[model samples]
Target chain A: MSRVGVVAIRRGIRVSIYLPIAELSVNMIILLAMGGAVGFLSGMFGVGGGFLITPLLIFYNIPPAVAVATGANQVIASSFSGALAHFKRGTVDIKLGMVLLAGGVAGSSVGVYVFALLRALGQLDLIVSLLYVVFLGTIGALMMWESIGALRKAGKGGSTTLKKPGQHNWVHRLPLKVRFRASKLFVSVIPVLGLGAFIGFLASIMGVGGGFIMVPAMIYLLKVPTNVVIGTSLFQIVFVAAFTTIVHASTNQTVDVVLAFLLMLGGVAGAQYGAKVGQRLRGEQLRALLAGLVLIVAIRLAVDLFVRPADVYSLAPGVL
Target chain B: MKRCARKHALAVIGMLLAVAVGGPSAFAQDQGEPPRETINIGLSTEVVAITPDFSGADLTIFGSLENPDPQILRQGRYDIIVVLEGPLRPVVVRRKDRIFGLWINVDSETFSSVPVSYSVAMTRAPQDITDAKSYKQLSLGIDNIHLRPAGENADPSKTEEFGLALRSLKQRSGLYNERVGSLTFIGSNLFRASLALPANVPVGTHRARAFLFRNGSFIDEASDQLMIVKSGTEASIYRAANTYGFFYGVFAVILAVITGWIGRIVFKRD
Candidate 1:
């Protein structure tokens, strides 16, 4: 009876075990126990469930795509609950999160719509495949360059330039100004609208969280100090993803509780230690490694476009 | 006594069962209710059998969509049945990268209909099939194929069949007796092949199996096997699809901020 329970839960399958002495399966029991450990890690750090968890899901025989969706569902809930806890501690940058959220929501809605469009045209994979190559390739290249620069100036560290928009750019000249006291700046709200929408759209289309895009944009584009970017970004993602989850659920019905919980279970815990470990390692090395990985993936995706490996071609209309 | 080890193992198993299975319910109170929904063409309602149609050759087998799912799969899970025509065609595989990403497919770029796996094979023997291209246009044509609606009539002894199409390096596939042995071959040498709809494809077969043809005869045949284990496979794929951009993005950004924060901590010496 006990073994049965372990197998069921570890697989994230909601199976009832009322047998007095239910026989346990070795695989299932360890898997569920692992979920708990991962969840703990998520609490320590500040991340959604999918990034680290889904891959693990595959380890237990879950399909990659299913693993990914399930992880998303779990991350949505964990983020909501965790964000609330963080809110109580006043660690979250609500104001900043809100701006990003506003844009993220807009972008995500449009992103979903765009996805629908691609689906309709039956060329969604084509677009997604294209965007992934372009986006990952560009970001990977930029990350590699920065990491190299950082490594060259390792001991002679100065400071990253907090670049703002050009004087003639419309963003700086916009009328309404938004201020983040912690970040210590007064920037135009217009940029947030445009930026959030862009990231949000990308997030939706690519099934990505938009943090990779957001963090960099905040630091370089708006010149938001690096100190507050992560926390603020998390705060924003909590809402944006939650909204996306709801939208996907109601509109697309793409949320999987079991998958999410399993991944979240691991990610939350992994994040805590990962944060600790991440702190110890060379940021440059991690960045370089990450860049290399993304570039490799990008090259593969780009070649796929010309080769046209995608099998389906029936087209349809999409919605936002 | 050997009984001692068995007892010890049982005890450990009991302890694990409580922890592993009970773990979910432990937080069941904490979790939200499961959301229920469906996609356009969802469910793998048949066991697609890929026979040795292309028997000894590195022939690329093609499939047609049976049940269409309007909503795309978030957790993409579909098994392939590599049914070949009687005898396979001349095969050359290549891996190349275009604007998209790395595609495992045939060497040709423009006329590349489907991305195919790059594996070399001979009629009498399946050689070390490596360094080949992935299938470019060898998959089914439909995305999000819809299954039976939620409230459709249930027939106890009814099966359904969807249309089938076969494409290869040639336009028309036919039986070639001279080359290696009695086998099927695509007629046209132009590059790609499309759909071959069969008139006698059984009606209402739930999910049926039919041969994939090129010109006028049977070459390769396949079908989909329904595996509705629990009815949540659709949601499984949908949920995890849109997570990467947000979550990892956050991790990357936060780490950068932490770096700056630590920089401040260390730079205090200056």
Candidate 2:
């Protein structure tokens, strides 16, 4: 009953028991265990752990940045676990993942540079928040919008209807000929790279691994099958995030290994269970729910932007 | 794993999805007890300045902080600061939002029950003295921290939105890191100035002050100006925007549509 939507609480105000996690207290253990639990969710659903963990951190009165950063650290481990499992299964498309990761790295570099530029300009936070709000909201609405349409169609006894293949356009005609044996398709690597770079830009800018976007891109742009797409994207995300974590850690020690380990422990187990449970839902139902969850997060972020923060210093934990 | 997941994903998703959309449970902690401690904010600095030739000269700022408080601090209200060093004037800059809908790359918020936070509020807002309006003014700055994608801007899209009311500056409000630093407009041909130290600036130097406050007290400001920064060098900042989420979501849905289409059209594979 404790606020079903953890991220829904307004930030900017102090609200909680004010229990600080000591250097190494039960709080730390809880944080680590919770992080792992969130990590499991990320693996099972292949979504960013922040979607779950950051809010949990906030619930404990942890600053949003720390929550987000810690969750990101945890993501490294969870993604690695998922990738390893997928690789063992031979479902991962290593070559494709590499191309996407290349784009992601390049994009992240640019995104980080831009982030610095904006900070120098003094508008980094607002832009990021606003963009997050708008982007997430629209995506959520689009997904929900489409899913509702599906539900309506289904209600009318026409749920399984399919539309014709739209125009292929230039995406298919580019020079490089690449093949995906699992999906039985041979296409240009250009689209893959372009998509990867584009998504990578977002990943770098946002500091997320870009799995939320990567999974879908593999399925649509590169035309991989649904089941394998998640596996393949995980393969790419694992390396990308792990490398990013290491780089960030080596550079700033931002990649909290302890945090990552905690998150991963929970994530691996949660994923196994989530996968088990996910098998029962219809595809649309799952999509609708996931989309809804995503939308809720996006809206909260957007609201945080324009609305007066419930309390200021939303990002300040130690500083505040 | 795949076999196991495929077999169970449906059930798991079904249960979660049902609960997710079913509406919030009424008594689920509408709001919780407030944090029980006073957080002492120690920072290096809160603001920075833009390099010359940047439409004139712009600035960015951030406040690094720490909790001197001994007890566990929840994330909440604490004042941050930004007193312009000089160039004193109002500035306008775009503060872009990701739009208020479900987006692709940007992260969607999630709920959790973790216990690691120090809730507090920053008491200082960035401001500049305005001789024209006869009062102090301040506004959000460029980028959440003076950083952005290439070819994009940190300025506001509207003129009126960029202008700050003295009363608003006088009255403190809530803020999030996402929208911090993005200024609306910083005058044409940029001017230079120093910012006044807001009363409660945490006991640390700022990274870039002029970069954050702009020309004097003409613009509304967030207190990131007084952050710890290397002197005279352009400070680099970044956001956690998650662009991949956008593309991934976009492409994933598109693929779902396409596959469903092709499943029916090509081989009736659906």
**What are the fnat scores of the candidates, in the order listed?**
0.03, 0.00
lDDT of each: 0.42, 0.43
Candidate 2, residues B35-97, lDDT tens digits: the string is 111112223333443221111122332332221111111121222333232222222223333
Model 1, A103-203: lDDT tens digits are: 88988887777665545444455566667667778988998998778776775775433335443444557778988777776878888778878876765
| Clashes in predicted model 2 | 218
TM-score for the A-chain in each candidate structure: 0.70, 0.76
Worst 10 residues of 1 chain A by lDDT: A16-25
Q: What are the per-residue Cα lDDT tens digits for candidate 2 across A25-136?
A: 1234565467556544554455755445544654454433334344445555455555655666778777777877787677655664665555445455555556556666
Q: Give candidate 1 misplaced runs (Cα > 4 Å).
A: A1-91, A155-170, A303-320, B1-270
Every candidate's DockQ is 0.03, 0.02
Model 2 chain B weakest 10-residue run by lDDT: B109-118
Chain B TM-score by candidate, in order shown: 0.20, 0.18
